[model samples]
Target chain A: MTGPRLTPLAASLPDTVPFVGPETQERAMGRPFRARLGANESRFGPSPRAIAAMAAAAGEAWMYGDPEVHDLRAAIAAHHGVTAAHVVVGEGIDGLLGVLVRLVAGSGDRVVTSLGAYPTFNFHVAGFGAELHRVPYRDDREDTDALVQKAREVGAKLVYFANPDNPMGTWHEAGVVEEMVAALPEGALLVLDEAYADLAPAGAVPRIAADDPRVIRMRTFSKGYGLAGLRVGYAIGAPALIRAFDKVRNHFGMGRVAQAGALAALADQGWLRDVQGKVAAARDRIAGIAAANGLRALPSATNFVTVDCGRDGDFARAVLRECIARGLFIRMPGVAPLDRCIRISAGTPADLDVLEEVLPQALRAAAG
Target chain B: MTGPRLTPLAASLPDTVPFVGPETQERAMGRPFRARLGANESRFGPSPRAIAAMAAAAGEAWMYGDPEVHDLRAAIAAHHGVTAAHVVVGEGIDGLLGVLVRLVAGSGDRVVTSLGAYPTFNFHVAGFGAELHRVPYRDDREDTDALVQKAREVGAKLVYFANPDNPMGTWHEAGVVEEMVAALPEGALLVLDEAYADLAPAGAVPRIAADDPRVIRMRTFSKGYGLAGLRVGYAIGAPALIRAFDKVRNHFGMGRVAQAGALAALADQGWLRDVQGKVAAARDRIAGIAAANGLRALPSATNFVTVDCGRDGDFARAVLRECIARGLFIRMPGVAPLDRCIRISAGTPADLDVLEEVLPQALRAAAG
Candidate 1:
């Protein structure tokens, strides 16, 4: 018998994962990595209060999580100084990006982003049959001018920009971001992804009116709150745009335990400050290890440090391969120029010790 | 400045939630639900092993769950006597259905289901711009022949049939299901949702070959496993179809604690057996309560029972309202014939005492 006929769009899409998780690599290698630093996950654990809340909520696993996500939304709104109607929570920023793409970008609709921005967002845009137009990064940071200009030229529906950018850990000042928001063409929404906002320097985060219809910004608990495994992220936008998410979202998708954990995590700002301190220290340690190995570490405001291999993409690839072979997990950008760098997330002091020991060996092996 | 313009389809769709969560009602009423029976959650709770596993995993929440989901997928495969290639895990069956609809049913593609089938599935179809066609239930069961006929007539890409169906608690035997599968149109896939399979009779689940490309069957931890709050569900199908989910799914969507909890829950089938016994006992208790009140309980193969109010949809709705007003949270079907009944989920001995106390008063109020 013939199988079901897939839609042309589905059939045309490549079966590719945006990120090959470290677990897949571990399985292929037949051993676990000594240091889990890939994927930019927090090496520091979530707040103890969050852990306790989740553990307590475990017994109530028989009931569905609140579909409206009432308590968490209220708490998030208070944290951001916005009304509840301005916030929408989803599985994660990745999931919310997919829904946001579906909401605005129809088949053949033009969407714009930088060449080396989050591949997951590009995956969503392609999956929805939208035409993606990407501009090259100007100087390892996303080119704001080129992105907005491209959006205007294409009459784009959505434009994606991440502050404290991934892979490079570089950021723009709040004023630059405000200019980008102001320059966004009519009918083109700016998807200002502030996933690393919690760790960003104070002046790096732009302050836009909550009701500004020009932008929808996403933030995640995965980074600063150290709850990556909880899969909670949210968007703050104009009320109308936020309400539109309910039309398509999986209403009861959030887990009850996750809700409790996030609530407790949000309440523990002291723990967040502690993580910020640890992350900053870890970033410096990673940079020091990079310098010892004769590689250049990029300036970073986020939790991770991106080290330039001081050579081409091929050399960086070899260095990355050597590190993986040496039981250290790390990643490099897929695009050129940027691919000259290897991205390393902040790890514990012990994990960093492994990195310091392994880097010289890996560099020597790569050179050979 | 104007907001981003929504795609024509998204603009046409009205913002709606598939189900109003009990928590929302509680907030409006200024109290908690005395008996939360509306959502068909397992009051029996998850296995203690699962709770323990999740509680332990909570401390590891900083690390993202393995996106490959290797261990859990392998375990689920072993349990079903299928290779891991034949399985794909997701946030829930609701989330999986959304992806499946996107994979096979493009905008304007025809899909068939019972008029009063799972509203969430319908929401996904609508969200993706697929055209949905509904058939009426026959003898309180899904009309399999009608669904198949309509699929052939309209060249439908998908047909959804839930055995031990929601809202009505009716199911078809294995033979009937096999016949229906055989009758699926050349390009139409059958979405056999077995959400309540663990609680169904011996012959209710069909033993389809793993490589059979004509159908995909979904199972969940939400119902019989008593982990509704965990949000873990899986689909078994042809390897090619299962792999296609990766192209569009949120690859790292499944939470770490959720994966651990589900793995532990699957290992402890003894807990499942215990839950089955409890559900069966509660079903009997609910049926007795209905009989005592001079109402008819539909013979159920599910964790919930549907009791006919012996009048019209209006009467059933009135009864439901009274039940809600009395601090009992229960639901009625949204469509006619089915709407002539109110559905109640299995509860603890203590919870059923509330239902027992409240159902009679609700009926009396409706009568008045």
Candidate 2:
């Protein structure tokens, strides 16, 4: 017997699994990871103040948080040197991306992103039935000129680019980003994701004035701020675009402890710097380990290091499987050229020690 | 210049405010509430075990939560004596409602709810461009007969009912709800909201079969579990209906600490029993206060008590305003007949004392 009818688009789509959590894999494999370095999480953890704040606020989870998120928004405004009107906080950058996609791109509305850039963003576009124009990355960096040209060719309304990009962890400097922003077609808007901007070098993230209507920048507490699990993120843009969020956003969605934890995380800059330092060191250690295993490590400005296996995608995938088999949880790019490299997040040295020890064996197994 | 265009439906709808959170009123009043007896938050707080679990999880806030919510779902399944596939967790009941509406009702699709029922659910329906056919409440309870007739008339795909009703703090027995479920139209689905079910008396919430395709029950950790601010809610439904969420849900939306806390909270039945007892005691105190003020308090199976103001919506509104002005922060329903009462949440004895002291003066002021 027939049950319920899904929307035409939804009916056509398969009930595919989007992502499998580490726990699921561990359960399948009958073992836990020796090094949890996949998914680009900041294993360095959040600031002590943030942790303290969360622990203290833990008892107050009974009450619903303020829907407007005033204090957090105000703090974000102060940090970004913008008015509170310019910011809209959400569950995470992932959540904001979904809302932005729904707002700007409707059924078959053209949206542009680099091929295999951010799967989460692509997932949202697909959810709303947006037609995608996926440009290939040039030399592991998003090809700015190509993306702009495609956006204009298709009259795409929303363009997504992440500076200090994920999976590969490469970045573009402010000047190049500003140049691309200027090239945006009239009526089109750029969604510049700076989720990893804090870990990048100075001038790596564009210092756009928050009032700019042509673009919006997305940031998150997930990566450098070290509160990924708290699910807090904000976007900075013209008030017009920012206010549009209220029209569609889940008003009471933000977690109360998460809000308090994020505010404290933002206030403690010293802890962020300390985490950043640890991440940088971890990246170097990963690179060294890769080199010792006769692989090339991509230069990264973000928290994870992408190691090139000096081989094809199949070989790299085998390497990934071997590593996972050995209980070193890591991941790789899904597309060609980039797929020849496996991505590993920065972890504590002890965690990295497992990675270093396991990689050599995994490489040998892959070659065999 | 115009920003991104809202859909034609969104453009036509008025810019409405669904809720005025207590924080908003406190900001307006320039002081904190002495008795935070509004919004029906559990003043009993979460279980001590949940608090400890959350506090311990404070350090791991940097990692993205398990998108699958595997552990929590397993625990919920075990507790309910059902398979994990029967449960789907979300931001809150509001979020689950949004997903359900999206799955079934598109533009102009007929959906039914009680007039002045959960505004958040209505907000979601409007957001999705559904045609809402609202049946008025029957004697302070959602009218099951009227709702069934309207659904048949409209050929509605979805019908929403909240048992142990909000604002009025009223409920019907499980047998009546089961009858309502059986009487629903073929191919139509019912959203049975049991947000306050735990506090409800025996026979208040029906035991629908786990695989009942036509019925989906909504529950939350917000009321009895005392974690509204943490934003954890779930739905129990047939796997076919539940799996639809995977197509569009923000997979990693739930916070890790929140997941852990909710799991721990659900495990501590003793704490929940203690809270239930406290809530029952507080309800008695609230009724007594209403009686002293010459107002009849409606019988409540929920955390809040509704004091009948002995007139239409207007007089109760006046009482609500006075309470707000005096920093009491109590709320009343926004619509007719039901607004004939002011809603006050269960709070501590100290909090109740403040309510007891201030409410009479507010009632006197409103009488003028």
Candidate 3:
């Protein structure tokens, strides 16, 4: 009649998830948000061709997706001017991070990242019972020098750095990133999370060799490609390193419709350019709204704008709560300093209109 | 620079996958499969309602699926006569099994299952660095008593038993399963994989209390519900046991289309009943096909039939190769005794016509 005993590591872990999705908040409020500007999801939908592919693939839902994910991998490799051996696709960047962590870091292994970086990465590190040493964000951007120093000091197995970073949307140029790759401690692999790569300005992405063993870069269809719901993300690294994923990954985890949609989406680079323009325009609108509210919007190279609330974490928290109460779903960074800002995603015109109407009132309510 | 160092446990693992998907075989063969009966996917297809839902959801792919998966969980709970807390949905049964193994069994922990029961389960156990103790199948079925005895002997943390089992397609009634649950050693958990439950005979699925902590039962939409490509599977168990999944799982791994399609599929039980009838009829047709070829089909309560090749593993392997060479995608069990058989999934009448034509030819080729 007793339950099975969880492993010591599992028992020691908490039940807290990495992020509380907006759907969760909507359920709690018993109503949907007027603007879905959280989680950095694209308000601009995926390519019409991708939608058609997914719709067509839906009827073929009885067949398991190819375990090797052949066509998509080949397509992605060709797009990047690399071979299939250098890329491995998974459920998403989150899923790949979990697997990569498992493959490299055993219990008590050292891992490094920015303190207020992606909580999902931290979650994976802790889940695998690895010790995570986090350096602070230096001036609103991930401090590459500090991260490398920390990795060398700890002899860390992995270092996670998201370029054109989430929450802040600040980015280092290609040369800066290339230097970061060069600075990786011996035997310490850098996990370059370029989830927002498609939305980044030209030259923001580095020209690392596809066979670079010191780093594995992850890119997602979730951001600019606008298919977060499909859960397709991929990693590119040395063939040997990429091959190791097969040893631990759920071989047939990818969905058939997801593969089809992603392939079609990748093919429609024109649709991607359209999304990029729209996201850029939306970013400016968000900045304009922030300026009108007497708040400063950080210069962003990604799909979201981080509005400095010009106060403490508590004030930002209050503003976030107020926005949520006013039927706007928004989020703020969890740690201090970074927590002084509230993050917003690119939204449709109507959605942004709702934000425009709500922000002033929300700020007034929070000021009280 | 050198690549990242892998954990000793990960480095010790091999690159061998659980199953070679038909697509991989097709690629090697330089063609498509005429009859894809290897993976046990429902060629009968998903509910029309589910396809429609998935198609509609495809356009909404910009949004990440609800991380909490509230509605689908509620629907699955309602279908199973349990509360939402008692059910936890995941990417697939394979994905869930990996998480479950990580939750309960750590490095060097003992787990028990039939030798050839399910390779994917064994893969997860190995991937997690758990030591697996396998008992042999008895008379082409998983030996429940032997499994229980071994679990007790090893003080195993987990014991996996697939009812209406895969590959062999033999099953035990509910009372036998209840007895197995009662016989679980102290602190040992039973992973009851009822992936084929929807196609099983009445009373084959044991009714255990929702609060039973010693056993967690998994069911999938991939088989009878005919949505393998959608990748939705669920486990029912005590709330605490189910909650542990949140500690380590990829929180937002399930796709939006998958959730929507599964919800619609659950609502259309009539479609499921129709599938059940079709599967039963197909099973009979397969048995007839095997008789015509002078082979023996194992009695099955599953969507697939395992036909004993009437000779050694070499003969079955040869027959499998012949079928594959003829563009008939099928599989054989990996372990001996069971390896003396080739497994075939329920396919469309058109697909079965190809199987009927190919099986005899394959048999002749193997004989030569």
C-alpha local distance difference test of each model: 0.93, 0.88, 0.93
Over the stretch B1-368, how does candidate 2's per-residue lDDT look in tens digits? 36655445555544444787788777877888887888888999999999999999998887778888999999999988889899999998877887778777877788999998888888888877789999999988889989898999998888989999987889988898888888998877888889999899977978899998878999899999999989999999898878888888888999899999999999999999999999999999999999999999999999999899999888888898888788787888878978899999999999999899889999899988
- Tens digit of lDDT per residue, candidate 2, span A245-276? 88778888987898899999999999889988
Candidate ranking (lDDT, best to worst) = 3, 1, 2
TM-score of each: 0.99, 0.98, 0.99
Model 1 lDDT tens row, B1-368: 55448889898888989888999999999999899998989999999999999999999998888888889999999999999999999999999999999999878799999999999999999988899999999999999999999999998989999998997999999999999999988878999999999999989999899999999999999998889999999999999999999889999899899999999999999999999999999999999999999999999999999999999999999999999999999998999989999999999999899999999999999999
In candidate 1, what are the lDDT values of residues A197-224, reduced to their tens digit? 9998999999999999999999998999
Best by the DockQ measure:
1
Alpha-carbon shift of residue B64 in model 3 (angstroms): 0.7
Count steric clashes of candidate 3. 0
Cα lDDT of model 3 by residue, A210-282, tens digit: 9889989999999999999999999999999999998999898998988999999999999999999999999
lDDT, candidate 3, B1-368, per-residue tens: 56548999899999777788888887888899898999999988999999999999999999999988999999999988999999999999999999999999988899999988899999999999999999999999889999999999999989999999887999999999999999888888999999999999988999899998889999999999899998999999999999999999999999898999999999999999999999999999999999999989999999999999999999999999999999899898998989999999988899899999999999999999
The stretch of ten residues in a row with the least summed lDDT in candidate 2 chain A is: A9-18
Local lDDT at B298 for model 2: 93
- Evaluate model 3: give its TM-score: 0.99
State in Å the error of residue A337, model 1.
0.8
lDDT score, candidate 1, position A189: 93
Error of 1 at B167 (Å): 1.0
